[model samples]
Target: MQLTFDADVEEFRRKFVEFLDEHMPAPGDVTERSKSSAHVPDWARRWQRLMFEHGWLLPGNPPEFGGRNATVLQQYVHLEELSKRRIYHSFNPQGLGIIAASILSFGTDEQKQRWAVPILRAEITAALGMSEPGAGSDLAGLRTRAVRAGAEYVVDGQKVWTSGAHDADVLLTFVRTDPTAPKHRGISVLLIPTDTPGVTRRPFPSVCSPDDLDFNEVYFEGARVPVANRIGPENGGWQVANGSLGHERTLLWLSFADRLEDLLGDFRPRTELDRDAYARLVMDSYALRMLGSGALAAAARGEQDTAALSILKVLGSEASQAASERALDAVGIEGLTHPAVTAPPPPLNIEHFSASWFERYLRSFAGTIAGGTSEIQRNIIAQRVLGLPRS
Candidate 1:
């Protein structure tokens, strides 16, 4: 069966297209150098601010939160259109997509105004401080400690693979608040300013490229975060962490299908094997979109299927990696010759798709690892969906 949106959703798409036509930045407005750098460019910040002012930055949010309170399907369409064009609403993905969402979900009214609004409006950027050296996939095992000290929580630990921390204003840090409690129960989230007296960030290059210095190792040496900055109750950070991750995975799973679609559109198959592979990739992209649509439908009905989300995460990530591999193969050795040391620009950059096939191929591996690893997703699917016992 053909997948399609109803008339109302189509109308929403039409208006959104009009908005884009009027406000979308001209090529060269956001330079390739800026897109590749860790710093958020002035142009990007302005673009995000414009979208927020127009109620298109996040269409599902209320007007005060940079949205028009659009329907869930309309919101999906908004994201799909932007993805099809390779446009990102915010340069800070974790800020807008995950941390801000978590703050809005669990933060008090005052906290929402203090953090979420500025994030949605692009006045400030945030980084997720979830993963550590020992707790990449299994967040429950994170060892970062935050001991309560009067009106402040003294943070002392390290966070690895923290994207954009070097340039971010704040880090939504997860720390062990109660060591005596169970692993998952003792966690808490602290919005620690990057410039705090004891906070230090060291930028690190990813395997994708040496110039890709987006990831950082952040150290907190007796960093004193105000108790008022704590999100959710003390030792109640597990729930906040789950909400944050859920927001991240949900956005990522949908974006993967869009990225695959873009890849398929740009790919030119040469041989019979290439042709077959291209066809399969196209089918996989379609399947992912269908699955995403089903998930959206369920959400609209006030139903949530965590298993379906896991399956989407696995399929979408693997399909993206496979698509990138096939593209590299189609181009043969020449694909391998693309300069690998330079940072890969954002997808909106014209050169991003053309000159960086090798970079894209390397970066595709991150999709599988981020949000949750493929192995972790499979275990979740087996236990939660199939009702299988833990291995």
Candidate 2:
């Protein structure tokens, strides 16, 4: 279901739409090419510079720290507009959004100056190295150790599923600083340069397809980082990690609108076997969009309901699955058969959609698994939101 906006919001939408239409990189161009393994594409960096020059890359930070200091409503409006156009600047994500935000909230002034400007200007890119092979959802179990020396911390551990690490200039990594302390208490966050000695990156094949590029494994062996690089207090990295995840959950869920539009395309199966199933799909998609906007509104108000995020994570994944399944059933033989030809020229060509549907289906399957699994979300909602007793 579509929604009506207030006049002011409608005007914001108009400008946003116009900006994206004018500035967004064309598909199949150099800007659209997928980089090697979790690497930042050059076109994406150019796009980030464009946003920086336009003063839209990161709007919440102070003007001194490379942000527009836009209001929360404006931020929501901007994000919504960009998501609608499937436009996201890749290079500035770390410096402007996560890393810079984290630092501005906690880091020393010198640290911010040294790091924040370059990130905002698209000069440096950073990847998050939080999930390890043995520890992903259960972050407390992370075995990566950061042993402190006189003035540096020597990090030695493996981080799995480190997205965009290969092309990143730095890594905001979480490690255990004090094993003796309780699980979550002893952890620390470090901003380690990827070029630091003993840091290695290896590509991991995608579960869905080799053509899909993202995901990587990182090994840190005596990866030395200055003590000054720590974002928050030692053993208090959980808060930083949680904060990053909170932001990520919101951002990831916002992408569902694009998924919905992709499902609504012409090649979508026309045959409706069950009226109830079709109705359920339509209703669920509507609900997802409404809840997404509601979440955005709340976030703009400086309030984020994790329960709402959890519900959206689970429901949106299910909705994506349902839409894909229904579309496949609708397309029948065509769905089963792989595309044999390249897409034709502009507006008419959507072969990318066809090629990506199955991959998206499999990737969305992990949506429930990534931020927090469905089981984890259910427990969170039950215990935190519903105030249920732990079993």
- Best-performing candidate as measured by TM-score: 1
Per-residue alpha-carbon lDDT of candidate 1 for residues 97-150, written as tens digits (9 for 90 to 100): 898899989999999999999888888888999999999898999999999999
lDDT at 313, model 1: 93
Q: In candidate 2, what are the lDDT values of residues 112-197, reduced to their tens digit?
A: 77776677666787778888888878889999999999899999999998867877788888999999999989999998888899
lDDT of 2: 0.71
Give lDDT: candidate 1, residue 253: 74
Q: TM-scores across all candidates?
A: 0.93, 0.86
Question: Against the true structure, whose lDDT is highest?
Answer: 1
Candidate 2 Cα errors over 4 Å, as ranges = 1-11, 14-32, 36-38, 91-97, 300-302, 332-356
